[model samples]
Target: MDLANLHFQNPEAFFLLLLGPLLILDWWWHAHKRKSTIKFPALAIAKKAAKGSKVRARYIVPALRMAALCCFVVALARPQNATEVEYTSTDGVDIMLALDVSGSMGTLDMLTRTDQAKLGVMNAEKVLKSGRFWDYSRLGYAKNVMAEFVQKRESDRIGLSVFAGNSYTLVPLTLDYGALLEILQAVDDSSASGNGTAIGDGLMNSLARLEKSDAKSKVVVLLTDGIDNASLVPPLHAAEVAKALGVKVYTIGVGKKSGTFLAFQQNPWTGEISWGEQPIPAENSLDEKTLSQIASSTGGRFYRAESKDDLEKIYSEIDGLEKTEIQTIAYARYQEKFYPWLLVGALLILLELVLANTRFVRIP
Candidate 1:
């Protein structure tokens, strides 16, 4: 017999301990208690009768009871042997990247101010600030950073959203990073005609997109520069909706009112031209307080980005934060062990009864 197969939850085997003392006590009590006395006219007749009959039957009740108890005790310990098995499955993460494409996003924070145009700006500051030129559009910065973030997660399903005065889906939730990047790269400030920021609408759109996902983990990355200005739905209400559906939203506030570069453009085809590069002032200062509250309400974090570098670092951190759905399988296998013990107990009890009534039986 395999020792492992004879497992007991109570390792002390308490039933065995009780049975030993009980059997011994029962045997001793019976031995001293039962006595046969004869009032005989002749002593010789009584002696002759005692020699013909057995003094007492030994070992029947105690032996049978001990055997029965042992079998029953062993059965109480549920035991099973392990068997190896194989398992296979697949799962991934779902993420939505909601970006603000409002016109104010053309704020320029990249490259050192140079030439006579950069004059009056501190020269020592310019000398210290020489860096690579980056496109000065909120959409452009978001596209580049999100591209990098998505590239690192091959197993995750990604989607895109552009929210301005209104919101619209640029890409539905999908695993095709190629298509997502293309849509994100093509995004321009012209996508939104209204000058307002619909931050709440954007979050609501992302939440609606994830409603059917059924993914183990769902997330929304909302990047915006303004408050709930043009949105019909309020940011807090949208967050409550997300909480109801068990989705986490990470909010990124882009652009600061002071010292960030801003670029203007001309529609050459319409012959309408706009001039000058200025520091982009927040139409409404980036709502860090509201954004932080949104993140906190849903077990997420808020990040503030005033420069392209800050945006890049934020994306790297968010990439690290995104988690994949996990799946697990459990099983229970039981072996029927009680029947054998019950059968043995019944037979032992029956044998005890029969020996008491038959072989060792006496006439009244």
Candidate 2:
């Protein structure tokens, strides 16, 4: 039975002051209205008539009226019981998304299956001619899948990073999923300003962004295909930094078993054509083994994303993995019922008026 009240401040003691003035005014007015008494004949007959009447003997009527007024005033005070509850809210993970925008990610290799290639004998012939090729490059596929992933996670605070030859924080950790998707959709292969990959730098940049987050869990989802070809700090060292800061790093390897060729065009002289071909060995391209080791060292898992669907599934899994607990406190506010107290005062004044005009009437 906890007692509390609602007002501009504590108001439980205010009622005592309110009724005091009225009681004093009533007592003073009644004490001053005394008149001289006159001898009356047939007093015995009057006393006999009063004996049979059932009217109140004392001030029962006024006392009953005061009791009713007290009830209404207490009700207006708005008493409430205060309590505290503890519950877990599983939605409080803060994440930083480090995306690989390296030049090699532009290599086209992901293939899409269509119904046109599922028909009959003609379909079989077309399928044979369809050669295994991807319509979009790895970077483009990543953009599409990440856009969807950001839209699905509106409750969590997320940040974005783009790394290639150099690393930069494009969007700091935020809960604005729409803005994050807008940035994702706007990303193009041209955004890979650096010609090389800096996986270590990217991881370090992500950790820096998450430094200010005071959450129960902090994590980084680092997606890269190329090894750290250009970085002052090594990828393994960056992973160690993340571990020291209590940040988990989930590594994603995006590409195929056998990496594809990265294509480029160069023009020399006005309108002169200069086309060349070079095979970037798939083995030296993306260092998945190192990435897996980094993730394992930081109590996180590594995932492989070879296509758009694979990328989406990887993000879905990450979304389910990171979570937080939020506890919300709810209670009703108390309001002062001074208006009802004043109303009762008005009723009492009105009752006094009626009594003076009829039952308690006196001849001036």
Candidate 3:
């Protein structure tokens, strides 16, 4: 709109505008040779456009096309208007999420409902007695909960590291949460199943992601349902590395001990519950002592996610970590202003096309 400040990125493209005059002259010469003269001040020509005869409309189409050509030439020139704007930025922490995918995580003991312990036990019973696999097992439940945790940290750079018998980085630290979530959703669909828990491998792999991160605060959230039975590096050794790197490690032990799956039922009509508890098997633990030490050594707390609610609560606590912030200075930037010209050119060409193909169709 401001002709005084109009800028064209590709000013050389305006040479295309020269074709408009030649096209109009060629059309006029043909019309004059046929003795079909048309006068114009285009405003007057448009006044009679709807009632114009087919012969008269012939001349109008070429002029409409020429006008469209001129508009397009302006668009090709890439006109823009530069304006100044201000912006502010914030510093967000770097995080790595390490999840366990060991065979023990396939146990149908985690809850997807409230009053987790009772519901968790009841749900496990239903899945077992009905002979149907609970697709949302310990790992499944963890993935679902962790997806929500990822969404809450929008400004931060987060990565994911998975471990079963071994550990590897699944996604590197970045701000692209959308792509991260899609990859996370596909973890169970793949055949990357593992048989043992390598907590140290997973933790160390996660720490490696933040090795070069320059953020003021770095953190790792490690969630697992099994003990570290297969790792070359001990979990404590990884914790020491994290402490030295000034990265906090929040360790979470999820699901209950193996062989402790509970059984309880309710009468349909009486609504009375009954317990058929078997003799509790010797506890198969997640080695909570080691997990706690790893967390404490890295200046972070250990959390026990005994049920679905507990798991969600643990993540909620980690989400409350101290956030770092720094002010950004305001600066000037340029914004393109050629969109209107391009849109106008496109609409004019479309109108000319519609008119020629329908109401102005030539018999020849």
Candidate 4:
């Protein structure tokens, strides 16, 4: 029981407290009016003797009785301790993140961060020296950004699906963001061993997960850097299926217009080889028209991400567009505290009776 939350259940019973003062006043008035006559002269000696004796101590009995009466009245008021409980009912959205892990994701075009302050990546020279090869790739940047995005959603149920020449659902819709990010971070270019991009299969797999969802708002955020080259299902047919299922699909294309490619050469006489980066026109095999059509068909948007910052901004925009709904209810539970007060009042009254009869008794 919390003493701080104590309150009276029946406050009207407190009117009994007025009886204590009235009883004290009546005792005082009677004692004052009833006076005895003395026939002896020089009464100063008798008054001095009475003043120095223990006669005044007898008033303790009445004081104890008054205190016991106050306790009994408070106990009758029925004090209680109140405890509050709060519960939330969330109507959250179900989201599926479809990622492309084709071999083209290994390109170093938008992966190398010149401004360390922006993406918080290690220096290019350090990454090369440390043999952390994937740190300078598109897949690495995408995984980092997606992990951060997952942390921002609190109430939403998120799922993951990765694809290359084929598609696989890495996780089902769940509220466990930690486990989902763990699986996402472990994904690399080797995750999809096949050599071609299967955009249709990816979307179909994502839709398969969303199809089972009972959420009011179902969505898919599909990201890719290549055109569909190997898929059993057609991209347009997949979009039609998404529309029929009432699922929105947001598509994001990642890459720059112009980027660098690694060129390698071998010394014929010395039998040595060296590799250097060469400037090349970026190959954007990404089918932007089809991606836009898919997005439009499902009442979603299409975004182009040329840099890491652009990708982050696109994800942030999507996060803002899909908001979760939550409702909270609060109530209190009260426990009866009158039992302890009743026991204490009874003990006090009993103690007063015992002391009055023995140590502080008076003659009638």
Query: Using TM-score as the measure, which candidate wins?
Result: 4
Provide the lowest-lDDT 10-residue window in model 2: 115-124
| Stretch of 10 with least lDDT, candidate 4 | 115-124
lDDT of each residue in 1-364, candidate 1, tens digit only: 3365553444455456576787788788987797887577999876676533343454566678778777667666543443435343447678888888886664454432342245324343333234211243455667788889988886788898888899988899998889888877777776665768899999999998998888877899999887778898999899999898889999998776566453434566984434335654555578889899999999889999876778899989888777564555645454556667768878987897887677766554
lDDT of 4 by residue, 1-364 (tens): 2245787878888898888889899978987887776575768876676442456776776787787788788788888888889999888899999999997876666744463333243344444445354655677778889898999999999999999999999999999999999999899767775779999999999999999799989999999998888889988899999999999999999876566744334568975544456574545457899999999999999999877888899999999999888899998878888887778778878887897888766554
Which whole-number lDDT from 0 to 100 does residue 355 have in model 4? 77
| Local distance difference test values of all predictions, in order | 0.74, 0.70, 0.77, 0.82
List pairs with backbone clashes in candidate 2: 6-334, 89-326, 92-324
Per-candidate TM-score against the hidden true structure: 0.56, 0.65, 0.57, 0.83
RMSD (CA, Å), candidate 2 to true, equals: 8.9
Task: Give the number of the best model, judged by lDDT.
Answer: 4
lDDT of 4 at 298: 98
Q: How accurate is candidate 2 locally (lDDT)?
A: 0.70
Weakest 10 consecutive residues of candidate 1 by summed lDDT: 125-134
Query: On a 0 to 100 scale, what is the lDDT of residue 30 in model 2?
Result: 80
lDDT of 3 by residue, 33-137 (tens): 765345667877678767446766576677778777877788887777766566667677999999887766656566444434444455544565553333456
Better of 1 and 4 by lDDT: 4
Model 4 bad stretches (over 4 Å)? 1-4, 29-48, 51-53, 113-131, 259-275, 278-283
